[model samples]
Target: MNVLVIGASRGIGLELVRQYLDAGQRVIATARDADGLARLKDVGAQTIQLDVADPASVSGLSWLLDGEKLDLALYVAGVFSTGGAISPPTQQDFDVMMHTNVLGVMQALPQVAPWVEEAGGQFAFLSSDMGHIGDSRSSRGWLYKVSKAALNMAVVAAQPDYPRAQFLLLHPGWVQTDMGTSAAALTVQDSVSALRQTLAKHKSSKTIHGCDDVPYLQWDGRPFAGW
Candidate 1:
């Protein structure tokens, strides 16, 4: 299978590229810069320079793909920031998070979705459980949560436009990564492994759970309630 992993320079994106390549799949990974890309290339992935926040860069991916059909395309680009009630998020923080997490997905989907649809493949956005309004309790990471909530909406709105492809919003659990930190509940390997298994199970399935009217889903392939 042919796979496309966006924001693959590090963390979950990087792991996804590695695992896909290990499975003998043709993987194309992208990052904003060349940092960490050499490692991905070393692992048998074709690396591309892409910045989802930049429209020109996203549009360039279309030409780079050369109309090659993609079996799976995953958008894993996002940003997070933590601030308590005493110290709220700054304007810069909001802008960076929203641009990368929300607008970036909105812009890239149009360019990448068609490629997946052409091959009857799957397209997914890496969202977070914090985005689930029904599961909300704490006020921490408000900015990050709001950005992902917007991303969920974007995914749902775009689904109807691409009837042939499966659109999923996956929550990769609380992974122990740079963003998730050491205190996170799950390790990156376990999280990615479970997500890969879920992807494998749904590879040929026409229905996308939780995507009929909403786009909230867990990494274990279960739908989020009250979404």
Candidate 2:
């Protein structure tokens, strides 16, 4: 299988690339840093340097992979702001997060969606538990939270547009990623394993139930035992 992983330079994105490649998949890992892409190249995965915040880059991604076939496309590129959601919110940080987390996904969809649809593949995106507004317990990282929440809805909205493809709005949990900090519950390996399980159990099937639970997460999606 061929996979395209965005934001493969660091954190959970990086680990996902590693795990996929180890599973003998042909991986094309893209990041904003040239050096980061180069490192993944040494690991038997092809690399592309892309800035999802740039429309030109998103358009160019299609051309880079035109000659190849893709089986999985995972979008995990995001930016984090220091402002704890409410106080001292910086305009620059908000713009950055919105571009990377929100608009970027919107722009990327038009390009990657057709390719996956033509190939009969899977589409997975990284959402967060924080994105769950219905289950909001508190608020600190407001910008990040809102952007990811928007992204989740974006994926949900796109499902109908690409009926043959499985669109995953996955929550990797509080993983110990660079953005996640060391105090997180699960390691990249553990969180990704759950994500993988969820992906497999829900892959390429359409019942409006392409959701996950870590086989153990509490209060995942809405409703119970029905699609």
Q: What is the Cα-based TM-score of model 2?
A: 0.87
Question: Which ranges of candidate 2 are over 4 A from the true structure?
Answer: 82-88, 207-227
Worst 10 residues of 1 by lDDT: 207-216
TM-scores, each model vs. reference: 0.93, 0.87
- Model 2 lDDT per residue over 42-118, tens place: 77778888999988888887777776656789898987754574576678887888999999999888678777776
Report the C-alpha lDDT of model 1 over 160-205, residue by residue, as the tens digit: 7887788878999999999999999988888899899887776654
Specify the highest-lDDT model's number: 1
lDDT of 2: 0.75
Per-candidate Cα lDDT values, in order, are 0.85, 0.75
Clash totals in order: 0, 3
